[model samples]
Target: MEKVVRHRGWQWLVGVWCMLAGHMACAQARTELLHRAQENLTRVIVHDIFSPPVASRIYLYANAAAYETLVLGDSRYVSLHNQANMFPKIDQPAAASHINYELAALYAFLRTGGKLVFSEPMLKDSSEHILAGVGEVDEVIYQNSLRLGEMVSDSILAWSSRDNYAATRKKRRYAYSKEKGKWTPTPPGYIDAVEPYWSQIRPVALDSAAQFKPVPPPAFNTDAASDFMKEVKEVYDVTRKLSKEEILIASFWDCNPFYLNTQGHLNFATKKLSPGGHWMSIAGQATQRAGKSWIETSKVYLLTSIALFDGFISCWDEKYRSQMIRPETVINAYMDEKWRPLLQTPPFPEYTSGHSVISTAAALVLERELGEGFVFDDRTEMPYGLPMRRFASFTAAAEEAAISRLYGGIHYRSAIVNGQKQGRGIGNQVIQKIRLNAGIGK
Candidate 1:
């Protein structure tokens, strides 16, 4: 009788140990899965050469799909199916049975990411590897996860079809302006403006693209003593005296998709992350540091993506509307005919900086989710051969990115300063208006 009792006690201990080990494995898998998803997104963005606005749209829908699907599995979280704009009616998972939340979230993330990115084969292979790592579970649980992921992906894709992405893709040509205060292509290529019709694309959170336009850029003045010329001179003067640290900051946040590298006769293009992509990487880093669960990480990506999408819309609306000239253009025309900006100016209208608007919008959402004054090492640019940058807070990083444009001589101080304000407003709107439930009961 004593031997039998001891044997039973040993069996109980073994079972408990297995359960704990399984839980730990799932936690590790969740972080690995999210990290892989983000990497695939970067790959697709670089290979496909998606401009910033199009990249933001892809991130928004894909992250939202993943978030809505994952939240369904966690009783501690609620779905955003009906809460967001133009959300499709998706089939809900079975509420009666015990579902494996980890597998469900992983499968959903894979499905959503596969749809949004161009590197389909790589993403699919990564998903299969993740599923294998999940090891053996009940066949019903596995099948259910697969089915639910497919449903969520289809729903999100259907809704995205109506967002005018296809229509905008057809608009390849834009009118060129010779007006002194208006934008014209700059340096290298000096090609037609990129995504001139981007403002017409549907915004996820904003009422319209023009919902919050920044104040008009100060009137174009050629007079060297005028405020407008002073703004141009500031950019010129700053470029002349850029410190080594300032140059590093400028290069760190360049985020120019069309950067060209030419040495002698060997010219090749360097593919880098867009502004929105950089913020997405930051979201992934913050979530990993916080030890967030799949549901929590999904929320971070979803909100940050939406902020980028809407922030770009608002910024571009002001850009094309105001038709403001870049500092490089103004400086060359009036100050020094031979002068060029320290950094290559991107081919787009300037008013509110795109980097400023999106970075601050994403920073605010991240701060809200990951505590105020949270510090982290941003290694996102390291893979691009840039050194890691440490930030006291997400806001600090955003502010620095805003100022880097000034130091780079690509934007005036007014555009950088006002762009931060516009971004903060957009971020506040996202935090207050878009409701996500912490618990599933609601």
Candidate 2:
């Protein structure tokens, strides 16, 4: 009887020890996973600044998965599967693979909730999903996994989500009409008062779709002008040459964020431009105190604040309507292959430079709001890890930069000239509309 009792006690002790070890391993895995996810998410956000919409959506979904993981502890897998159903349109094989990994991880975390050991299959699936998404080969995966493993082994490290980095408050005082129940727009003569300065500024233009003589389409291969094709080829070559997924990821990442409509206004306002770059610093300061908090940092507010979006949209609509070819395409084949641009050509039809129209319109709006004397420092930085450059007035910055593309071999001088003129017209129209709508100083 005594021997049997002792044996039973020993068995119970072994069982308890195994359970405790499993719990510790599970906790370590969760912490490590969270940290890995957060690092990727940060990179995604930074890269999104220049990216288009489709890629940005994928990153958004990844972020959402991480958030769910954090909230539900080990139940993130089930949560993601549920969420995947919400985005019914994202049924691509690649996306489905990612969903499966999340599901597996969630299951492992839940099954061993608080246990120390994670299922090997779950870890493998998670790692595979990440690798597949970025197109990294197995070797790169091993390196990332090793780094994560080292971090996991350390008990003190913890992971947290990145905070919202966008500006989200209004700085100006605004009132809505009580009787008519509509927000009052800014006054009309407000913009006309600023028009004289525009006449002093140089105009920018684009390739004439129809000439004064009405010539036929220039005889040339249009495919040579395709920026998309160039990008695809460049990406393929980079992947082959470097064999580093990080570089490829960085390239794609750089182009994704700008595509999204979210928080651009806040980003633009809060973003420090080059000194003497553009706009009145006083206007940036003045609007820092007006209206609803959320509206203040909105893209609409910033663009409208300077009254540039109106002219920008008008010019854009007309430019695209004409659909002119860029100089990069024309000059390359007709001119020389050795002729390279100083600045990369923006991907779009070139009629009027979008930057010129928008920048000039903003300058006009800023001059009106803050008067001609208001000056601010420019602090805009270059994309990627490039060095920062400074400027003087927004108009000076706009004009020089617009012209720089010509010097850079990307745009024709004509396009720059016509763009500037079209932008001015658009700015004047926007000012008139705002004044008429606002019932302000007419």
Candidate 3:
């Protein structure tokens, strides 16, 4: 009886040991997976920010979706650092950190299957952390570090790489650009002549522009704008209604980008590269040189699309919140109905320009990723089928195009300015919280 009892005890002990070992192995796997997901999310964020506008949008959305899935698993804490590290390389470290924290907390709540709420103090702490960590690095290097983190994470976790996704996306963008044909250029003399007139009215322009400044909820009235002001208004209105003053208190908080009808006469005449123009070809060449695979290259385009759409929504919300009258509304009331804007007005409010914000924010993010001094020849086509004009910097091109909306009489100058600021804010916020497993930030 004693021998039988000892045998039973030994078997039970062995079984317990095996179960413990299996549990440990599973825990390790979960940790590694979480870490890898966090890393990939970082990379995706960096890549989306640095890539072309279209490409960035696509990747941003996909990254967000993927992150959402990962956050639901055992490795969810990996995204905790995202808020601390998002836009860690930008000049506005404090703002970036704040955004990162806000997003991280939101993601945490989501992962916990809890309700979402924005936390201001946490975001501020995150900004401080990032600033302290990257105090010495140059802006470019700092930005690259964020990207490197992503690359490392993806590689270790076996996620898609930027090069591979970029290649396929580039092909599609290139095909679209080809179909759009060439854009006509604005003459040097015309630009020069316009500059003097623009200078003379600059003060009045700035003053008038102040009226369209981004207002928080309760102050902004979406009902005042036309029904056509759907997309642009949605972003502004939603943000104002949702975001608290604490959320808007950051130094770089005002740097959001806006959109407007730049497709008018000036845009056509400038012969600048349009968003839909030969982006695919440019991306393709870049991808091939890097030796990226198809899955990786395709992600570039996917992210870009996502960003663009998100920008549109965000900007629209802003407009709705402010409910400020559009240039068309004011101008038409005073001027002739025949005095139409150079570009067809988008079906949204004119307070904040969605395109201006998205494009500028995208440019800022891309410039950081691609390198500040790096210049690329832009042979891409423009809207209205004109020849492409080259630019030294993506931001410069986007800025010019954004301002052109004012000159073309499609948007109030103030609207474009505010839009750009807002767009940058949104982009930074979104970029910081991207984790491979966590997905898009709240």
Candidate 4:
């Protein structure tokens, strides 16, 4: 009787050990899967110089697909297929077979990311290698998960086809405006304006691009004493007197993918994140810092991406509508001929700053998702060889990002201030419309 009792006790200990090991493995998988998504996104950003609006659209669709697929395995989150204006139909899994959701998420990212990015072979091979690591222990479950991921990707791509992204690509040419106070390509390449038709793209949350138009910027005035000229003077004078800290702030938020290198004639350009990519990295960092699970992290990315997508649309509507001049153009025309902005002015109309709008919009969603007063060290820009700056909260970082445009001498005060207000409106709409739940949607 004593021998039999000891044998049963040993079996119980072995079962508990297996359970603990399985739990640990699951946690590690979640962490790795999230990190993998962030890395691939950075890859696409660095692949070429995508304009801010185009980059936002890419981020939105990829993340939306990943979020939709991930939430299918867990009911704690909701899908945005029908909630967002025109997302396509995604079929639910046919069977209740056990799925490793982490594997499914990585697979979903692979499918959507491959379709959106230029680095298709690299992304596809990366996914296959990752899936291989899951082992052949459960081949049937693995195959089903991959199929589900592909199904989600196919639906997302179908929806993306109607967003006017490809149509805009055929008409990429934009006419230059030589009129005073109008945008002119500045410094560096001096290429024609980027994405002049961006506002025409379909918005994820906004009813239309003009749904949340910001007030027009102050009218251009050539007189030295006029308010418009005064604002231009402010940009010129502030740039002239920029402190070291101010310079760092401007450099930190530059987000110009093809900023001039100036190191050599052969290598005169360096690639970095666009404004949208910068905010996406911030969202990923915030989600990780909050110790969120993969399911919860997907929500953060989805919300932030959608906010940025619509924010860009609203910002671009005001940008082209106002056709207001950039500080670069104003300062050179009316203030000082020799003056150059502390940063390179991107080739586009400047009313309603893009950086300010997207950054604040992303901050709003992040704050709502992660709560206020969250502090974290930002290493997202570190890979670009910039120093990591710590922030007290998401708003603090966004406010700095908004003001950085001023310090960079790229935008006037009105554009920066008004952009934040416009962004907040869009962010609120995303929150009000999207629903979250722990049950499957109809």
Which one is best on TM-score?
A: 4
| Candidate 1 per-residue C-alpha lDDT over 370-418 given as tens digits, one digit per residue, 9 for 90 to 100 | 9879999999899889999999999999999999999888999889988
For candidate 2, write residues 289-392 as lDDT tens digits.
22212111222223332233234334444443444555544444444545433334444445555555555666665555444444444322333443333435
The lowest-lDDT stretch of 10 consecutive residues in candidate 4 is 1-10
| Ten residues in sequence with the least summed lDDT for candidate 2 | 187-196
The TM-score of predicted model 3 comes to 0.39
- Residues 140-246, candidate 3: write the lDDT tens digits: 44443344333323332222232133343333211111111111112212111001111111110012213223544222223446443342343333323433322
Q: What's the residue-level lDDT of 266 in candidate 1?
A: 72
- Of the two candidates 3 and 4, the one with more favorable TM-score, higher being better, is 4
Residue runs of model 1 more than 4 Å from their true location after superposition: 1-25, 95-99, 263-267, 438-442
Q: How accurate is candidate 3 locally (lDDT)?
A: 0.36
Question: Can you write out model 4's per-residue Cα lDDT over 88-197, one digit (the tens) per residue?
Answer: 75666886466666667767776787788777776666665444444333666766777777788888888889998788889847776666676667765676777888
Using TM-score as the measure, name the better of candidate 1 and candidate 3: 1
**For candidate 3, which ten residues in a row score worst on lDDT?**
192-201
TM-score of each: 0.90, 0.36, 0.39, 0.91
Candidate 2, residue 280: how far the Cα is off, in Å? 12
Cα deviation at 296, candidate 1, in Å, is 0.7
Error of 1 at 58 (Å): 1.5
lDDT for model 4: 0.79
341: Cα error in model 2, Å: 1.3
